[model samples]
Target: MEAPGGPGAPPMWGPGRKMGFGAALGSRSKGWYTVADGNLSEVFFPFLDHVALHELRFFVSAAGAPPVDDSGDGQHSISWISPGVPAFRVETTHHEYRLTKDFFSDPEENAVLIAATFTPELPDLRLYMQASAHWEPGTDGNFGSVIDTHPPALLLQQQDIWICVVGPFSRANVGYFRSSDVHIDLTDADGHLTYTYDRAGPGNVSAGAEIGIRAGAFQLAIGFAHSRADAEEVARTALQKGAGAVRQAFERAWRAQPEIPPALGKVSGDDGMLARASFAFLHCLEDKSHAGAFIAAPAAPWGETNHDGNHVYHLVWPRDLCRIATALLDAGDSDAALRAFRHLQSQQRTDGGWHQNWTLDGTPHWQSTELDQIALPILLAWRLGVAGCLDHDPYPIMVRPAAQFIIREGPLTTLDRWEDAGGLSPSTLAACIAALIVAAEFAHDAGEHVAANHLRAVADYWNDRVEAWCSLPSGQYIRLGSDPDRRPTEGSTAPEFLELVRYGLRRPKDDRVLRSLQGVDTSLKVSLPAGPSWRRYAGDTYGEQSRLAGTDRRAGPALLFDGTSCGRAGANT
Candidate 1:
């Protein structure tokens, strides 16, 4: 039976389904678009953290066969059009026809342009464009309509957000989702648009139009604006400019980035290309309005069957920011790295703490606090200070408050980096200890001798207790701080113990560290044909289940529920 309308929830957020994303560099463009399954997936506007458009899908049908949804039912593959830019060429080979979509964002305005071409145009080949506009972060009450325009267009709105799609179409329809929409008609046995409407609103709705394919090709533009007129103009301008020209601008904009640093210029071939790609992707993740803010990802994890809107992945995390900042610093973009530090300063809580994660506007989400998150900023500041990148002192604004917070809540944390159980996690403790030492140095440089001495003492105390609190009787480090006598096997191993060496608290050759390494390898590591990989830990049940499994395993103590008898498939994350 056909489910009608469209997908009930947003598409998957993992890169597998979300694929690659592209946006114009700098602030000229305010929209970011993602490609997946040979079609446009989520389109974020104004901010990287907020998802405005659910998906813009293309469909094709012949005289007597069911219409093939380009993103829904065909075998599709994606490759980068430009080596380091987000521009992508997604090709889908269907049983009846082949389609190619070249995706890129407009560098001059807020729009997503796609140059679509279908080969072997079948007899009575009918092309359709479907727009599923969530408007906000999730799919809820939305209004869609067919606007009166030259080439015909569609407008969707939710609250203050408005999105308009413009292209060349002969016929169009808008209706409520599921019960009476174009999707229902497209999925019917005949694969035709039998039912149609002028507008649908105040509930889940969808809009579709019959695209006029000229020479087996069509161009599309999706634009964001505050009003319908503005959106129309945005989309019209991009379409008028043509996809090829806009794409050229997109490539030129990215290629115009600052010259590669010595660290990046040293490598060549695929490795060098991969490094440049990393920097380009990192650039795409940052918020346009907020200089230093970058979302963790442009997708929602487990979005396939998980329709719960509350569970999201596109948000800011201080822990993630630390890595991003450090990467930028290593890539020799000190300006970007410093901007990230300043952004952190603004997001820091009045008590010198940070929430688990947050939106770009510093709106906190998630309840737990990981000490490493509180400490990593100080570590980054120290790194920047050491590299002489600290144009203005961070001592009073950032370093002082963060160091004080760690002093008030060190060693013991409410949760680990995984947001699971909280205790004296060696990784968290390592960061805290390392942060305190650096904070003391910053304080000493700032001439606050008393504060500097106190921070150093705290660092010393935490460093001394590293082994006592984390080590088990076997000299292996336990995953968390607890009574070693009653510790279970599942609690005996974790990959986070390596932070001891990472933060310089212990030598790589240390006997205790070596023993913990072996324990982790024996318990959590999985040797695959490609290479050796490690799960979060043993007895962990926080991932997709295997196709062969019936139910998930019983979750560990820190986790809520493990499956009863299910096998698990390893995630590539």
Candidate 2:
């Protein structure tokens, strides 16, 4: 696309590239941008220092205009809306900067260059600059500026690049500009400039520029920053001395990366429906990890606000942490998988349950109920086994106390219901019992018979209750102590039944239970290798699914029997 300017516009101000920033760097800086074949282009430039304050601008032709909307708070921003394509935009008021590339281009054969100029509208301050080749995210989850040795930082010289201080600006600021496999230089012709660059392997060379001067009209160049008669000569020297060898080395390193299949998973249909869904789930999984102890859905808490009108899902909850840890473990990030376990152990309540939700500071704000909290240790212990990380036999200490609390409080009795605050549901009691049973097994493995006995008693209480509440008409278990005056709705039973099935609790074989399970299976299935089937009974839908009536199907839902009941089919047997 053509750069934004009138016909025959004299090369606007700086550089010889007629395409301007629009062609080279794209108009916007936020989303994604490309230089080579669109497929080999994955570039991101996130400004750190002014991320929160400054606005990012992208100059796109009509063909590339992003979906525009006012960020509910009234700020103007464009949403890329399109999936997969690398789009660009800017962010204002950031503190640190970051760039990510997925080997879309060849560093040696192709060059990716970026340049920035600082012109102070007000003059009285000098821009202090520090730039590095690459920085990884800090332990605190923010990006850190640490120079890595494997990819060396590019050298900088001021002969060709003008590094003049236009004015003594009030604020001393730092800015960065980086390019891969390219020569970089800063000169003090019109103003001071700073440059950062890295090279992977030998091939084509590229250059980038970054300058921090009092916000004003300043001029900076890529190869030559100065306007001297010998500026080209100086620029060539800078390129040869500062960039050539580095570019060659970077090219070699870039090529060394094993070319495995792209991380993109399977796609279904012409529209790539499955691929889109997978991308969304994976993106959410990655971004959610950024929440520290929890995973926030990509839609955040905003899209699915809780009953309290707050964004509960925006913060990490116990359930999400468990799912995220499992996903991480599955993805081969064992270390990160363990972080959630440790976080859960650290947050355990004195009574052995975890709070429902917490803010980023780890402050518990919502209800500190039994169900949510109980799931924490249970999930942690389960993951320990799944991830092969529980060599120390930490399950008893991690899980027994919670189980004991449930046993002491009376199993199948609502200990605490966050949603109703005062009322208890049979399903809640069942879930608590199910968790305690798992905990009891862990206790038994640890030879903690006393804890095991207590858990066993809790399980007995729940089983007796389940037997009494079993409804032949529904073929599913009814919630104990549910008000007879209230009508049972699909929402009440589906989730509860699904949870019981998923967690390995025995359900009566009455037609109603069969019908209920079939109903759930039909509603939640997405296409997969085996067949369309119900999604797992996550807590959100557990309560509802549990109440449905059973139906006979020639083929039953895919049943994943927990170790305890892998062979058992009937409660009597």
Candidate 3:
């Protein structure tokens, strides 16, 4: 899809086309706006609407600034700098800047990437941008929801610029610095030479030179500066050698990325939708070695609150990582798939639960609030083994402790009695069972009789529990016994249950597996007046609704199950 704004849109400017002294503004949707000053020296994008499921919007703007002095003179500093935009309200005293719109509609979403930039009229002007994402609370009014509210505040003061991305209970911050001490000099046939120096380190640096040229419909230039020399000399040299080389290198890098054929149109129909969904899921997987696959909406920003301590929609979790990783491996991103497992291994807690949140600093808060710990990691490990990322023997070593934790601790017992301590609910127990089944298969492959027997024993225990629960009506499952407010009617429908049934029944047909799937199929199926067996809800139904609403609300839409069985075509398993 085309970006929300056309070329050269203005900052803080609303939709429509308008001409000004040297500026024009336009927008493709309410979520985005752009502006271009007629001078052609700079452009600004003050609002970026990323489709993050969080309740936040990002506002960013950029402009050119005139060069003053680099002679260490305080006279060059100006406190009243302005980009000539009215929509941005700057509070100097509080050092806070905000947009004039209600960016969050629900308590669980916030606006992110509200930023502004100042460029210079010089060919290589230094770029200065201030960007930030906001955070809010979740819709559920539990204390655990509060943990998802505020954006993590990193302790770093100023040695490095803060790069903050909001996750479930915190923000991920990476510090970057530009390397100094690198200098270059270029000369042409005319004896004109331009000398440039590198100013590394995070804060802000100026690119003082721009090679005057264009390549492939883009303005091309070498971004550099004179080495404390005459401006005219540097400009002449940059125009001749530096600019050309930089432009070529950048073009090559841009073209190096994997390409999508132009024939790939908007994906429609079932097959196309599945392909597109799988592609998107793969694209979101972080290529970093230790990082788990993150399900971040492309370009989505963090959410913010309205100073009332009310929460909005900026959140993330490692559990989602496990889910997305399973999808990624299914989609053929084996490296990323393995990375997710490795991340789980690195972040597992001593209590046998995985940390729900993976912050930038690697600190696991171990919020004993929810109980996906034993379940998600174990399942991921099993999938990794099947995918050949783990060996059979190692599989049992990793799976046994987690399973033992669940059984010995009474999977249904709460870790935090006040707020549903990280313990097994039906959904979690089902996930644990599924992982053990996978482990058992791996053990059988490795000829480890002891491991296989132990796994079978554990699986039997889970099977008995599921069988007892199945004795209930079609929809009921065992709830965590320790939850005081637990109701027979309250239930969760994560793909976890479907995964358990599918994995458990992979061998010779088990009646229990068939019964469970039948129950799930019955409860999840929906029929329209026109047809039956043609539709069903996937695991992401709620997540998709949350994305559309721009908030974290559970009462959005119901999933439907048509003819497609849970494991065969539907997404849960």
Predicted model with the maximum lDDT: 1
TM-score for candidate 1: 0.89
Model 3 / residue 64 / CA error / Å: 27
Per-prediction count of colliding residue pairs? 7, 95, 59
Off by over 4 Å in 2: 1-292, 298-312, 370-372, 408-430, 467-493, 507-510, 517-573
- In order of appearance, the predictions have TM-scores of 0.89, 0.44, 0.44
lDDT values for all models: 0.76, 0.35, 0.33
- The CA-based lDDT of model 3 is what? 0.33
Q: Model 1 residue 337 lDDT?
A: 90
Model 3 TM-score relative to the real fold: 0.44
Worst 10 residues of 2 by lDDT: 11-20
The best candidate by TM-score is 1
Task: For residue 485, give model 1's deviation from the true position in Å.
Answer: 12
